[model samples]
Target: MTSLPEDPPSAISEGDRDTAVQRLQEAYSQGHISHEELDERLHQVLTARTRGELVAALASLPEENAGTTSTIAAAAGRIKRRGAWRVPRILKVESAYGRVRLDLSRAVIEHPVVDIELQLGTGRATITVPRDATVEFEDLRTGWKDTRYKPRARSRPGGPTIRICGTMGYGRLKIRHAWR
Candidate 1:
């Protein structure tokens, strides 16, 4: 007799699930994912009720984050470098929330900073940084329950440094970094 197919979370699609996992893994390796936080997100992705829910969760993630294929990159999003010597990076993203602009360009790049600024209009966000990179926060506030920053290891020199600033009209924000 033929065997039955596995359930969605179990038989999670490679594209979306894999993407999400990879993003999660990258964040973990970069010292951006804490054990507890990782477990929680993993559970969410696996047990999500609908494809749209999963898609939204994964799609609204920060760059260099970890997870499997479930998370797909947001298209139509833009990241541009305005300056020359000290690149002034600008990220303009349109999500379920309104518009948002993230300014970095001047962020120290010696540690290979990868600043990820997202406009999460009533949406969630996930940002991952190198294991040894330093992290600083400013004007951080959240309305979602259990809003917290996942702990991460510090990054070595030349490793990527990620700075993520977002406007959450109404949502959660998870920032993972490489710092004490």
Candidate 2:
């Protein structure tokens, strides 16, 4: 006798839906899917009842990178990363006396979580994250100025989380979310 068709896949939970939505969003951001496709797949993921349905929503998307750690150091200049640059899983930035600007609004971030460790001697640093991202700077230590960040009341349901850590000696750090 058939074993009840292998007991079908289990029902998708809220966490599963959230994760699927996040994967869709990431795929859209990486230019893997169009806006219209993203919207359609988002709807499908949100309304999916079983794991199979949820998996179908993300069938053709490319797998995310395994991620690697990279470092950017400067003696007395500006460290800037903008445009459609690829963001690694872990980034270490060291500057003796220069400004750091990391614009992730249009960057390609494959990892769900990104950690930025900064060692600044002086000057200001401005980091612009994606509109739906979550910024965490609780582990940062500022010697001269405090981190300037205004957290939103509610972030997107399934957005990436950016963790900022390390030390800023006599410098200011400003973190802001990208504007729509």
Tens-digit lDDT track for model 1 on 1-180?
997553232122334455566666666676776777777777777666544445444443455412211112243343222221222233334466432222223222321344444545565555443344445545344455334565543233323345555455576665554222
Which digits, one per residue and each the tens of the lDDT, describe model 2 over residues 1-180? 654333333354565676678888999998999999999999998888865577678788876555568999999999999977778889999999999999987776655689999999999999999777789999999998999999865565445689999999988999998874
Give the count of colliding residue pairs in each prediction.
Answer: 31, 0
Q: What's the distance in Å from true for residue 163, model 2?
A: 0.1
Q: What shift in Å separates residue 32 of candidate 2 from its native position after superposition?
A: 19
RMSD of each: 17.9, 12.5
Question: Alpha carbon lDDT of residue 154, candidate 1?
Answer: 24
TM-score, candidate 2, is 0.66
